[model samples]
Target: MLEKLIDDFKLQPPHAVLLALEPLRAISDYVAGIVGPAEALPRGDGHPVIVFPGLALSGAATADLRVRLQQLGYELYDWEQGVNNWPDADFDEWLQRLGAHLQRIHARHGRSVSLIGWSLGGIYARELAKKYPKLVRQVITLATPFTDTGDSTHAGWILTLLNGAAYAVDEALLKRLSVDPPVPSASIYSQTDGVVAWQGCQGKETRCHRNIEVNRVSHMGMVHHPDVLRVVADLLVEPC
Candidate 1:
């Protein structure tokens, strides 16, 4: 069944030309974040929030977004795993470690923690929520292509370089990733994303799940785009 879906999906990565504009668009987004009307953004309830960076990115990459969240009254935390190059360790081991970290945070706060993740990191967020649903309040994914992990993303070469010839799609994993976590979740994506296919970034919307579509935001800019930030802020404060 997974194979049939893969065959029929025909997912393709965003155009190379569009990908080329990623850096410039990201810069524009950063600038827009600076002048963005954040005063109107909703405030959080001082709950703990952990942010997971995208593939090959470090906590620094999410610094701006974290700062914004912190200013909005949320206790922000880094993934503390340095760069997100998971190839250095066993995949299951990585997840176990993250789960343990989430457990500690939940225990410390005595409340469910919200998780915000970008790109591949979003996959981790969803999986952790699934494994430890009691510890998670909600989840928000930015430009994460959790539906199909085929060549639908331009990061395939990076994966190949990280895992070498050993890199192969796990159909079961893909299917599992596509499922929404038990907690309330929102996926913020853009049709103009220039890294992963937009289709792969969306899933069926239910009462507990929603898909938000932004416009003209580069994949790399998802973290700092003003529109993206506003949507994230609104969802974070929304009652589950």
Candidate 2:
């Protein structure tokens, strides 16, 4: 299984120099968001949308994105799970809690929810949608390497540290993760992403699935890059 994971998803992480420039590129993306001409976007139909943060990040990390979607008239919801530190001893419990949260939101709105996840958060979004397809309207993942085991990410060591020997590949989980969710879904990635290998960030494209690439966006910048936001906006308002 490990050999297969290596063979199938063994793309190299971004160059060290690119990793070093990530913060600068993120700043540039922020500036561009401020000065770029407004794009004409379709208004959201007030469906509930949830934004999930990346590993070790709290929902606060997605504030700008949430605000943008909210302005488009969508009801934005936080992950509300605090920092996303997955693969902990309580990982199953945490997922159960998340499932219950989703259930409550679905009950409250009486509508399927849209999920947007960044980095590792995107992995969670896909799995959640898979587990409860009837409750999800669509999914959009930003720079998430769901097709790869930790081998293709700069953050691989972080997962190793967190999971110890337990971090070894789970073929079943990997197989599941690599499959696109059963709802309308899009993967937004960048060739210049400086954390995870971009090749692992996409899946097979079908009528309801897409791999949209942006140029020169850092892995960390995907949450706020204007190009990424535009793609996300267009996908959100797409007819279901």
Candidate 3:
């Protein structure tokens, strides 16, 4: 299974058609939220939840989902840092800030906080769980490429250009990042993802780990997808 997943990770960029359709599909999903029937999922316990946006985007990219989660009784918090531009600063410094953010949330809530990250943010979420397992209740990723970063993303060239030497992914790092987090985690991906391949998004699923797929959704649209949001809500309500 590992070998198969790795082979599948020889990722390809999204097709022109899929890329072209992203805006329309995202708009449709947004419209559906208003005109379609809402799923009656159970409410959250008001636990503090922090959401991280994707690469090159901002916390505002996740606002819709965060607000939805908040409406469901979860205490939503932003990453605070404006845009997720990987090129602007040192990765280590960015991680330090995340660590501090997690600490603040824990201090305020008196409990481990759940983490939700999209794309690159998901990679951050997983590493955070590994470094501070006791402080993270659960981790949820939307279209995050974990198996191999370089080969998994359609935006590899962009990352290479922006991150320069830091974007390089060696075998040791790939093997390490592919491992599951110590806490409960789920990877939500789409086979037709236009940014990263679905195979790289999958990890070894165990009792506490899961890989979920939705049909016909773009990578960018995963953030607002109704089904994916439902899965996140369900996972958050589970016992810690």
Where in model 3 is the C-alpha error above 4 Å? 1-9, 87-93, 160-167
Go through the candidates in order and give the clash count of each. 0, 0, 0
TM-score of each: 0.93, 0.91, 0.88
For candidate 3, lDDT tens digit of each residue in 14-91? Answer: 676776777788777676644423758679999999999998889989998888899899999998888776525455
Give the number of the best model, judged by lDDT. 1
Q: What is the Å distance of residue 76 in model 1 from its true position?
A: 0.3
Tens-digit lDDT string for candidate 1 (105-204): 9989998999999999999999999989989999999999999667789987787777665456678777888999999999999988888999998889
Supply the TM-score for candidate 3.
0.88
**In order, what lDDT does every prediction score?**
0.89, 0.86, 0.82
For model 2, name the residue pairs that clash. Answer: none
lDDT of 2 by residue, 187-206 (tens): 99999998998998989999
How high is the lDDT of residue 235 in model 3? 90
A best-first ranking of the candidates according to their lDDT comes to 1, 2, 3
| Candidates in order: C-alpha RMSD to true structure | 2.5, 3.0, 3.2
Model 3 scores what on Cα lDDT? 0.82
Ranking by TM-score: 1, 2, 3
**Candidate 2 wrong stretches, greater than 4 Å:** 1-9, 89-93, 161-167
lDDT of 2: 0.86
